[model samples]
Target: MRNVVLGFLGTQLDMGKRRRWRPSISLCQTEGFHVDRFELLYDRKFSRLAHDVRREIERVSPDTEVLLVQMDLDDPWDLQEVYAKLFDFAKDYGFDEDRERYHIHLTTGTHVAQICWFLLSESRHIPAALIQTGPPRGDEEIGTFDLIDLDLGRYDALQQRFDQQTREYGDLLKGGIETRNPAYNALIDRIEQVASISDAPILLMGESGTGKSELAQRIYELKLQRRRVKGRLVQVNCATLRGGGAIATLFGQRRSHTGQPGTERSGLLREADGGVLFLDEIDELGMEEQALLLHALETGRYYPLGSDSEVTSRFQVIAGASRDLATLVAEDRFRLDLLSRLNLWTFRLPALRDRTEDLEANLRFELARAEKILGTRVGFNADAADAWLRFARAPDTPWPGNFRDFGGAILRLCTLAPRGRITRAQVDEEVETLRRRWRMAENDPDARLVGEVTDLTLDPFDVPQLAHVIRICRTAPTISEAGRRLFAASRETRTSRNDADRLRKYLARFDLTWASLHDDT
Candidate 1:
């Protein structure tokens, strides 16, 4: 398998244009790095330089192919835009070649570009080794280069100390939720380390259904199994913890004298003493609660409601938020100090849509759970399994709800399956039900309107194209306008035509019209 090299074309003119050009890419080829293909990202203005560099590499090493990628990016000096462009490039380029390994050339780009590459590799955003190339200092050598894996715990001399400790815990975390993504795998290992050694707060930031709560509880379990924490795990959804009772619920309260003789209650903080307290949706905490919580987290002291003396509760905190806490802090809704404390070991869980590669494994895991729950063994027929997996993993299936959606879907199938056996026909029927359900749940007025007018009797195969057409009809101001855009390419030679009537008649196939689609949902 040949290696694919990704790099940037540097603009530094240390070597004059007329001088004997010694490009890093050319040196890389000459040094026999075996870069079967080079994907160089550069600006439009650097076309000539990039072309010359490519030509030089091809001239020096005939087997190496140099391909230039044009980027529509903002200031090259701006790290934000540079990082965004690089990030977008990584997302857009499909790295589907199994035999070809990727290696990032960090020596031939701007400082910002090099930094972005290093960060991306470090975080496993780019699953590649960092290649540092430089001009040879000695007279006897070609350009000097070295390959470094971002995971120092994997290949470094200190592997025995840092890497070996978390190896078992890494496996444990993947017991239920299986993932093959390098970023997520590395994240599990990192989570194991923080959950094992440090008692400092750990924050899991990601969208809902990305398994934040599950991961939080898993962290506690890992700690408990290792005898790191001898107490029970206390979990709370802060979103549901609002109102006057928020303070009493979180910090406990003594018996009330003024009210109807309320009994003393142990709040979540006290219950979480000597253990891990996982707070999901931590951003929902109001400012007053935020202040009190910050004080308790910082000093381990909080006066329970209706108490004069301050009580102490020593507990490890782990917080999860679907929204960005920094933005909340900036908006003065959340405490900056609390944000600072929790930001120490933050990990972002990727959404299910982003981890579609793990669909098969996760789907099987969900089926196993359904079996345990229903106390009956269930299995999907070959055709049924294939059909369901295809729909679930399709690009258009925006898994806004993530894993929870998968669980619900599996439960529906398992509940309806006869003799614990799911057939292709059942899969097809359930798929249509889900499609109509999704259409009904649409929040957008135009999409909802389109869905209302859409004929569900149409063949399932026609839904994709029809759905797009309905959306176009709802958005276009006039029937003629919609038809013109739809027939733009085909009607290029014939500018004047009755495209409106054609489109109107086309919609009649589904018992619809342009006017009906534009109605509010």
Candidate 2:
């Protein structure tokens, strides 16, 4: 079924204002939807305008889905009151079906696009998400903001490009726009090489926030630019693959069992047959499924989940895994043969810490992103930079979480930074808060057997020592196992014993003992 997005452009409030509605108009036209009408709602405030919008909704099409759109002023607008207005209007107009048919999109032009998700009760903010217009902004007559598309698929594509370009510029451009990192350049070079190839299963391995998916898409686009493929890049999260029968869900299930009468819809793999298939977290696939995938990759064939008939499908396979495949294979959790098959062309994306040269560049990239997102300029003060420099090089804590963690901390400080500059104290406070919260959470019974190790001083001297302790804790099955890892083997066993004794004393001093190991206890 084709979904229709209908938006009402001007309000009485915007009538006299230097309004740019042409972009919105052109966008609707280009989107190829049947526009019933575009009436100007002149009321400025929620109380007055909502009633008029409700009337328009009923008049337009009482039975169809109506998405009421509005401009976000960034100023304090009473959201509770705004929703009340929409609710009252929907109730009066009889638009409220069991499942909410009427939707509201609160957009702030080219700035931050605030969303009011249709929850049953109230609307809350979805953090770290923003919306902006596309390039060659002149295409939209209502300024670039008029071109903001609310379609999820289109939005995802646009935002993906924006993030990528922003990062690229952060690395390549002058004036601190791009971040320079050896690892990023290396990964980009690898992506270029993969893009040059047309038929090879590529394995992308990295920690969670290392931009694996982004790199995968870049490879696809590069391939497309090189005239190697013509189909859309179809992506599936293997972590979320399910076993529900009725084959139609994966490929479009035939509407009916009778072949002659059923619709022949395509499965995701078929949809992307000529393009690329990106399977995220492929390590999550069960052994039986892994065998199926291996067969498909080897023979260019995959049967629908419940179908007896086999289908011929060929697509460039790009898979990502945060876990170490060698470790998974050793543990018998993942297939070694399958890994060998996909590892034909492999690229290991390094974590944020491994590329310290790129930290400044990444920070600049993220800061630009924040400015674009927040509709305001934001920068790191000398103090904030020093604080980051302090921990940025920690061998024991070089961001196991990678870019995602970096983005989060940067964003938090960006938001909290007064007058667009993040202070050193704020950085220190945030870091301490993070550590404290982590320690508190570790006290939970469900917490795993891991240590939150950090160096007291940002100097590189203690990093490896701290990391040794972390490695010892992570590999240990029990206190005794940890003891073994810490103490096993050595001609000069005295040093090992001394270190173990010192570590045990340190743990005791911090009230962290073997019993604190949740996975064990």
Candidate 3:
């Protein structure tokens, strides 16, 4: 195969006395080196010098052919111009890897040109290895040459840089919170990879306050930073989109019969074109809305309310659902087709209570955020901090509202701190307040359900647990479905996982049955 070397002419370096050997000349005349052809790029102003160098190359290496190509540059230092010209050259070049070996002469070009050459070669725009030539060491005219292959995997420094960048992106997605949970970190890593590469619909499923909306926004921001999206992110809560105006609110309305003809509305979907549409609580959307959404997702075309014409929108969807969308689909509440389309990249974010280990880190982050919000610094005393951390990490701490509840607690503490310091008394007060709130919540639902179903005085602890189970039973279509949801995490480890059997036994202890719970509900 013929060996081809391509480079820019180093006008000053190649124009010394005839005896002096330069980078381009030395590369061709090096001992034991064979250049079948040399493609030299030069400005039109250096046409005479380019001819002189080509003649010298042919004279020394009689078997080699030198092709002089003109690439006029008004300013060699302009990186944009240099890169664009070189990119165009590479794009137009007919490279046949099977017939010839190509090398990019990196030593002769300007620093900007050298950088552009590196980028082009690294990106495989120019399928070539980079070759650098330097002046001879002792008495040799043929100088020294080093070949550099742009394989990132082979370079530890480059690999580390890429790894660091990936870590930074993950941190950004997490709002700079130094989350230490292994499962959560792994989840973020997967999310980062998907957000960077895929434009498909992503569904984020988690309980309320579990950061679904935050993560969706982060995904949009990441895509924007990576230049994947050019339009703004349009966020809307599907739960609020109800009744007569839901369709118009989402798909927009055409001009009224009595209004101007050209004043047709563009809608949220149109506004989200070339960007992301975050539909929080997506399961709450009506059947008609779901059908329209599915159509838009599949075809990128939808009609405005009262309009005959169909408008187009090219957008990606990031859906957030607190409820089990699969269950909703099973119950015939949500459209199966819409769910299927959104489920391609579904991720379930673990609730705060499920990841208690990360509570301390999240608490500190919330504290920092609160300080910024209140424009005042606040810190817990040594004993107070320990007490709060202990209570926050306790297994029984419901944290039902997740980070939302956690952040609110932090803000309250900061606001009530005396002399910008939270003492044990303040911590005790806050803890009591949280306990009362949780107790009230338990009594409100549990007491009412238990009171209506049967007249039984139950232990305080059992009331909340049994109330939760009964609530799930009331909503789920079958005992098995309710059991599956309640024991989702624990069932994974059991050898013989019969959720229905387990749920039945637990309910039997309370002298209750799924049938009895649903009878009143």
Candidate 4:
């Protein structure tokens, strides 16, 4: 396959005719490189010079295809702005179909333009190596050309160093997070990657019981070990921060007027000045509190109530929310600017229900913790473990409370453990408690109907089949209608049969009636 080169048309071509021979063409010929094509990205102001560049290139290498690409970077002097535009262009360009290997010529164009190309190539925005052309000076008057690998990320030693650092960071943060789920592990890896280096406000968003607070503490610990923060970890549930003294409590009170300032009473933020300040359930903060919090974060200094002097916290903020701040922002409840600040390193922890695959491991983890605390180890009996997991992770059970409920169930089972072992009997009671709690919490009509199935005790094994029948019964106008729909697929194979009677018999086995279900719904 042939190699293609992409680069900009240097404005140096604007010089006198005899003084300029396109360096890109000379570099290829001098270095004995046979490029199949050349893609020249140029500004409209350089169209005439670009044409000259193309003609000069083909004059030397007639077989080389020259493609003129017009770019709209009016002024390339602003490196940041030009880099952004070039980066966007590179992303939008289709690099996937490049069957032929390619090189980005870095010799032509202004130094800023060359750096832009280098940045693009370095980040793999373009799937090619970098080509640099040096002017001829010695015996080799044709100068020299060098092809540089753009895979700087894959530099053996550099990547290995990064890998080792990541592993160390992962171990530090992975202390209690024992799980084998890929997505969850990936989330952990990402958290480790960001938490170690970023001093920016970190926002953790998730439903209740997803371990946001736990993760926040872990992050604090990691940073503390690294000496990123020197003070203690100060945690406060934003929901609990209320009453008229909320400001005083969070920011401390200044001494009364008259005499010199009294002893400085440091608030939570000041206490966490050199460490991490964790605000859990931040969505619950009142607008006034939010304003104060935002001001402190934005300025790194907050005023104590009744004090004119601004106290410096220098605290790293880690905010947790159970609600979507974006939605709150749209509703004008949350400050958009504050959200933007915290969103710099935002990570959404997955809900427990979404991570059902890790249920068994996490359950065992809680049990182990219980054993450590109570000094009595307990293992779930095979049947009990199976039964407990089934009931807890069932789709019918709305784990709206997530890991909080799961942990509580573990605690209950440990307390109920007999002979250091959880028996099937204990699991049965715990499962029922969870089911009842979920039933009460849910307001869905279907769940409400299921809760009305008072006479029947549906175990884990019986849930799937029984739940379907219950749904069909609630939705169908009559038992006959329910039966036909319930067995719609199977009934097609039945030459002759009463679906209503079949469904009736099925419901009778479970001690449920169609009339009872429909009326309940």
Cα-based lDDT at residue 394, candidate 1: 92
Q: lDDT: which is higher, 1 or 2?
A: 1
**Residue 256 Cα positional deviation in candidate 3, in Å, after optimal superposition:** 2.4
Candidate lDDT scores, in order, read 0.77, 0.57, 0.84, 0.76
lDDT of 3 at 493: 97
Summarize candidate 1's per-residue lDDT along 215-259 as a digit string, tens digits: 887898898977788888888767545555668878988886235
When summed lDDT is taken over every stretch of 10 residues in candidate 3, the lowest stretch is 448-457
Off by over 4 Å in 2: 1-184, 243-252, 255-265, 306-308, 437-521
Candidate 4, residues 1-521, lDDT tens digits: the string is 78888887777743434334457667557545788888888889879878887888788788889999998786777798778888887878777544788788887777787788877777778778888776655566565677787464658878899798777777666555467778878888988867777788889998876888788888998787767788888887665455555676688876662244663456788888788999888887888988898889988898887688888878898999989999999999998888888898888888787888888778878988888878998898899999988887788776766777677678778877988899999988877776774665374444433443533445655655777777666544456777878888897788866999998788888767765553221
Name the weakest run of 10 consecutive residues (lDDT summed) in model 1. Answer: 13-22
Candidates in order: C-alpha RMSD to true structure: 26.8, 23.0, 14.9, 20.9
Please tell me which predicted candidate would have the highest lDDT against the true structure.
3
Q: Name the regions of candidate 3 deviating beyond 4 angstroms.
A: 1-26, 29-58, 61-129, 132-147, 150-154, 257-264, 443-521
Candidate 3 structure quality by residue, lDDT tens digits, 1-521: 99999999998888855447677878887776699999999999999999999998888888889999999998999999999999999999999999999999988879999999999987889999999888877886568888887666568888888899999999999999888889999999999999899998999999877998788889999999888899999987675565555677678887872277874667789899999999987876889889988999999999888788898999989998888988998999998888889999999999998887788888889889988999999999999999998988888898766777677777888888999998999889878877766666665877545543443446778777887887677556567878999999999999979999999999888768776664321
What are the clashing pairs of model 4? none
Better of 1 and 3 by lDDT: 3
Q: What C-alpha root-mean-square deviation, in Å, does candidate 4 show against the real structure? A: 20.9
